[model samples]
Target: MSSLPAPTRRSLLGGAGALGVAGALGGAVAAPAHAGPWTPARFKGAKLLAAPDRHLVGRFSYGLTPALAAQVRRRGGARRWFEWQLAPGRIPDPAVGSLRTWWSGLDRGAQELWSRQTSEIEYGWAVMEDYQRYVLLRRTRGQHQVLEVMTEFWENHLHVPVNGDAQFTHRVPYGDLVRRHALGTYEDLLRETITHPAMLVYLNQAVSTKRRPNENLARELLELHTVGRGRFTEDDVKSSARILTGWSVDLWRTWRASYQPEQHWTGPVRVMGFHDANAAADGRELTHRYLRYLARHPATAQRIARKLACKFVRDDPPQSLVDHLAGVYLAHDTAIKPVLRALVAHRAFRASAGLKVKDPGEDAVSTYRALRVAIARPPEGERGEQYAANAILWQTAALGTTPFEWPRADGQPVDSASWSSPSRMIASFELHYTMSGGWWPTAGTGYRRPGQWLPRRRIRFDVLVDHLCQQLLGRRSTATLLKACSEAVGVGRREVITREHDLVRWSMPRLLTTLLDSPYHLRK
Candidate 1:
């Protein structure tokens, strides 16, 4: 097959920002409230994939990729590959290193971000953009796919956004907090997030004091963070507030959190079955004890398990599965790996194929991986990134969601229902069409710049269609799918069709876009 030409920087910058998808949505756009982590979607012509090859790639990673599928097969199957992913320390993430080229100050502290000496600027927009791109790259191309997937889930679970410079300064380290315990125990994860300056500031814990105990952090801790619901009362909220007092940020010292006994309320605090005395000044130790207790609570286990089940298994997970997963969570003392291992091993996970509809971010990542796009990193100041990033960001926004961009603490939904609207689906079709046509790739997809829709081997149109289906979907092209591709370029007979250059060239975008737009590719 011939290689496509690289888009010039001029063409890339010239409205590549829209990805050629501006105002291309169909019907009415759905409101932000329509989607969530558990929304159900009804996909048209969704593939019923019985093969574990596709299932594993879909479950553990963003979507099915040939490279990922081969890795799974190389590891002896899905389970072994999943086991390999569980220990990310064993995974060599060379792709993660390129992050510095695009996003600087990932290693800097709040002081650097506050100062002019570093790329960590006082403007929160820069940090937000860099971090968002960082998230996009890691999610799209990181070798530690499971870890990235889990980290995304946990980051959303412990949702914190950088809307302003103060938020940017503190929330810069939030991703680290999520990564540090991405596969560790939930107790550790909870304690780390709650103690972090970003969460403290975001949840108003930094301002909580003996005189004015803000219950925001305490409320979310019991209501959303830990126990989840009906298990904690207003008294618990008020008491937890007093316990969380003095967890203040040291602005003079890079916004590091420091416990102050002076601000802590002195008294015996009882939250549910746990009891601890402030000892007038030992609020830090007392708080830690309370947190551990909360983390170990059965309710917390059930809450986390239900969420996991919903994420990995199904939209509305069965009570049996939720209970079973909850036991797995508690049996291992809230250690994440065991619960996740048992989850994959569970019958529900194995049975779920094409069950999940991809979110906007997931769809975008899947498209990039499907096309085998080489992640671009030009000079520090470049137009390609601006145009490409704007396009991606807008597409994600149009889907009504993006990583860490959820304004609320609740985070973006994981269900398909929230993202199955006509408008979003049409936007996806337009985006994929643009990509398949090689319009947005300023250089091209993959290490071999100037991407091609046609395979290297000279094959017939029918064979080409079949090859594309396998390449993109890991399955053979159905008659319906083949007809959709062939007819797009006015090919009459399937058998009589030959290697017609112009027809194939014309059919490339239509065929590729149709395949990607199919419900099969939309679900994972």
Candidate 2:
């Protein structure tokens, strides 16, 4: 990869501001007073629970489909369902055939070359496209909810940029790396990323040579990846960077090239109080041993635990929960599955109602899933190619999570501050309205049609509203929302009334957007 401009603190902060969306009407709406913490009771044996409506199920599941939600409900609720997702291998791959084909086409060498060519922005677009397609397919065809959610979790955990000119290609390889080891040990995931072309480029590790060591990757490796701020010092970062030097990628070449001993400075380096030499005289075995040592460090365990807790449990999870998870990570050798399992089983995860804010990607995937939008590859001709291109590009852009295109090295933030800006809010509203209105020309056939498609069927405005309420709010709407939607429906003309299609098409998305902008939507 060629040398790139260094990303500054100001640039990163500015990027966050640019992604923020604005406030919405009724944004002050709070969760139901008696809703209580998220628990099995929230989804217990209730007569009203009808095969997990795609809209409602999409909130918790990756994509919503009646079949997928049914599976989750049958498995006994969201807690158990989440457990299955954390165990990546256990989640059945409904679309593995195409994915396998995609992977097989690349050898190690070609894979590296591809990673080097795709810009970060394009990479973001691709990842977002894949994510959207994955949700659409599962909701419309395959009905694999657990798989989708797990894929999402793993992707965010190991996020890489896909927007730079030469960064997009790295998205697939980086994503592949994450999926491959998502259920495996965190140590393994860490080691794989150390050499992964995507991470190297995104974090500037590729430029971290002996003569002028760059601390960009090293700082993030500690702050974001392993031990967060306050856990390590600037000196520690410098030393760590030294240890990571001589590791670079060959953009023009196919597979990842080996560590160049000639490029390495065989000198002493200290990381976290541990001193070691990078000299070949000490042998590659010793250097590798040190890498493994860092992987298993107690601080790494703590950092990983905190991140998981923030993701699955709550934004500010209890200290006790963090301690317990850290212990589990260390005991299990940083096994991701066990930590996730413990989280699902713990009271923290089950009881933390409305604690998390949905990132843009999650919101889009969940919405499409709930609607049961079917996304399929085009047929094996020119038309098929066009369909594929359109599907990949439009959905990603609409959802705001195009692959490999994260604007900064830290990746997209999961909190409310970054996602809830005025502009983003407007974008969300427009996207939701357009999707609900069935405005996208390319989204064919999936839109629900009454009478002709299914006799005795009529699209009921109330039913649609009710369903969307459950999906977006995990409960029915308040009197305020219900009244607003009813008034909106009443204003439509007779032609729209007889079909109830236009009303639903217009109101559903509006209602969803309004709800998403609500304070309740910002919570878990």
TM per prediction: 0.86, 0.74
lDDT of 2 by residue, 356-386 (tens): 5566655555555444455545443335434
Residue-level error in angstroms, candidate 1, position 483? 2.4
**Candidate 2: minimum summed lDDT over ten consecutive residues — where?**
36-45
lDDT (tens digit, per residue) of candidate 1 on 1-524: 32324334322222111222221122211122332321222212323333775676687797777677777777877788889999999889888877655656566667777674244333566667777767887777789999989998998888887565466777757887798799999989988898888898888887788999999989988988888878977888888898889899765346667888888888888888887766767588788888999998999888888888878777877888888888988888889999998888788887776567778888888887887767566445555454454346655666667678878887777666677676776677777877777676544234222225455534556666666777787776555555445444444323333345655545556667667776557777
lDDT of candidates 1 onward, in order? 0.71, 0.54
Deviation (Å) of 166 in candidate 2: 3.5
Give candidate 1's TM-score: 0.86
Q: What lDDT would candidate 1 get against the real structure?
A: 0.71
Error of 2 at 283 (Å): 5.9
